[model samples]
Target: MKVTLDIDPGHTQDEIIIRCAELNDDLLKIVALANSSQKKVVGSLGKQTFLLEPGDVYYFECVDDKVFIYTKSKIYDCALRLYEIEEKFQGTNFLRANKSTIINLAKVRSLNPILNGKIEVELENGEKQIISRQYAPALKEKLGLGR
Candidate 1:
């Protein structure tokens, strides 16, 4: 893949054009990355607070009928459901590791396949999550390992 960046000082606004013969995984990844960078997290406390930084998030998990955004320092309760969060972060390096968990792929350090088609993911922050057999295929696809 060849990438070119052109900057014109004469223009007041930055313009980006991606020229590609076809939309492949690489292109999809680039698009996903750009989208994720622009995504904002709004807390459920009704204050409408936004978390702009992506690296500040450890993972997002659904537990006991509530959604929670886990960070390195704190955890914030979210109003959205697990499926809603999954849709928003689908192509943004976030995967549904299990029925109740949506993990940030960028934070994953290693993947360990356990018995009965289950897998354990080790996050960069040393947190672990189990990937159910049903969602393992999708996780593998996101990892670029193919089906």
Candidate 2:
């Protein structure tokens, strides 16, 4: 689908207009996302809990048993398990880079195929995540790069 964004200073409020020939699953999800009022994930740094926008999150990492939300400037502890986070961010730009990590595809800078059959994903923040060989095919399919 071709997406266009128009920024007009004359408009009073931000609005979304979808022009499609037919309604399909992808269009339905797009409408659902647009109609949803809020999409947030809670993360904490010490006692102060912050509501973080899922879009700002670079990726989620599971170290040991804890899940941490990584952003451009800070790391916050998340209460959701890796799988739970996976389910919540479904249909969005989030993709499972590995068993222990969920990466936001919007933050991806590049994908490089490595010598060991794994894919190296470089994030916009310069941090790299490895997409295991087991999940590499799925990643390629999602990006429409697979045959």
lDDT of 1 by residue, 1-147 (tens): 777876778889765578888888888888888888888876643555666466567788888898888877678888789899888877887788887888888888999999999989988878899999999999898777856
Scored by TM-score, the top model is: 1
Model 1 residue 133 lDDT score: 97
Question: Candidate 1: which pairs clash?
Answer: none
Task: Give every collision pair in model 2.
Answer: none
Runs in model 1 with CA error above 4 Å?
Answer: 8-10, 44-48
- Residue 124, candidate 2: Cα error in Å is 0.5
The true-versus-predicted C-alpha distance at residue 48 of model 1, in Å, is 8.1
Residue 89 error, candidate 1, Å: 1.5
- Relative to the unseen true structure, what is the C-alpha lDDT of residue 144 in candidate 2, on a scale of 0 to 100? 70
Off by over 4 Å in 2: 1-21, 24-29, 32-37
- Model 2 scores worst on lDDT over the 10 consecutive residues at 29-38
lDDT of every model, 2 decimals? 0.81, 0.87
Task: List TM-score per model, in order.
Answer: 0.86, 0.80
